[model samples]
Target chain A: MRILLTSVFVDDQAKALHFYTEVLGFVKKHDVPVGEKDRWLTVVSPEEPGGTELLLEPLGHPAARTYRDALVEDGIPLAQFTVDDVWAEYERLRGLGVRFTQEPLEAGPVTTAVLDDTCGNLIQIATQPE
Target chain B: MADDLFKALADPTRRTIIDELAEQSGQTLFEICSRLSMKHRLGISRQAVSQHLAVLEAAGLVETRREGRYKFHDLNTAPLRLIVERWLVPRTSEPEENTP
Candidate 1:
């Protein structure tokens, strides 16, 4: 499936946006008003450009808030994103001073890695044979 | 809202439908059929689209609100968010990338 966007709900919108766009280098696609103290924001990979969108959902809704908290409490990751050149992408992010939780490693046919999002999640970057 | 959204988005047809409904209010089955046909060059019948829509709706990825003569299908974010959160846990460390 062509994933248009991936959404991560966080408590602080400002911090989430800073980490995702500034640190990770995901270009912002949208930043609009949605609700009180909430904004509908999105980003995408520079390689694919506008191919897919990454939604930075604010965590304040009772459902989203509870779910985010519970998942953090359980120490679970929300999701992962695929990159064409994972090793290159890993190094690029590393140069940007981005901290990684798991270093890049070959897992069978797929080369995978993980990073601490600092938003209470570990985002996985990988390249796998479809 | 990534994995479940990705899982919900796993199918090209459904992803196309989401892209179609990206900004618009909503659409009926007939409208969906025409748009998907012209856009994706799909030769599938309306029945096929209906079946696909059923999967989307059943997964809570899409919602159907009753309108006059047809059911207006609108995308739902709640299910996508919930499912992604649920999938965060490995659930006993199953093999990764087993399914698309």
Candidate 2:
């Protein structure tokens, strides 16, 4: 019944790890070898280590590439992360050379911004009303 | 070309799309759709929005650009110049009629 994990298809696990951990400030939660060239890598927010885990699943299926590419082309984010302040996070990420497809926009009660994940996906960060 | 421009601007939804694009150029189709639904309360489908963009593209009011793996939609008001030139400019020059 509980949502334990979610996934995003990454083009490269190594690069995704660096971006997710070093840049986006997530900590590695799991890194088990799956096969000869693949690993079951996952990362969790530093704020919530026991919370939901984000699996940086590899782009194994050919269809995943087409799907990701089409979504990226149209600036559709595969996943969304909640942030305390979208504008602050957007500025911080942009300072680190992260390219944003959409800037921070206030729509009704929520504010959001979209950034390129560099691992072939767009990620949206938002701040929702409490 | 003018027919296409006028037709593109004739719809309320398309005009709202223009208004959003004018606020910020170079947006993705997803962003545009998000704005329409979230900001403007437009509940149209993505396919319908895409079709509207195609109509706007044909009218030169919108231009799309490819940047690496991403494609962005940019608003181009150049075609709107035809509207000003077609009617507004001529009326301004004929002010002598009212001077009498």
Question: What's the i-RMS of each model?
Answer: 19.4, 0.5
Question: Highest lDDT: which candidate?
Answer: 2
Query: Which residue pairs collide, candidate 2?
Result: none
TM-score for chain B in model 1: 0.69
True contacts kept of 2: 0.93
CA lDDT of each candidate? 0.68, 0.94
Sort candidate 2 into its docking category.
high
DockQ, computed on Cα atoms, for candidate 2: 0.82
Kindly provide the TM-score of model 2 when superposed on the true structure, using C-alpha atoms: 0.94
Give the per-residue lDDT of model 2 (tens digit) for B5-91. Answer: 889999999999999999999999999999999999999999999999999999999999999988899999999987877667855
lDDT of 1 at B20: 69
Strongest candidate by DockQ: 2
Can you tell me the DockQ of model 1? Answer: 0.01
lDDT, candidate 2, A21-129, per-residue tens: 9989999999999989999999999999999999999999999999999999999999999999999999999999999999998988899899998999999999967
* Fnat (0 to 1) per candidate: 0.00, 0.93
Per-residue C-alpha lDDT of model 1 across residues A1-130, encoded as one tens digit per residue: 6758778876677888888889877778889998677888888877778687888776657887676545433223467778888889898889887765445645346666666576656577778666
Query: Candidate 1 overall Cα lDDT vs. reference?
Result: 0.68
- Model 1 alpha-carbon miss at residue B94, Å: 46
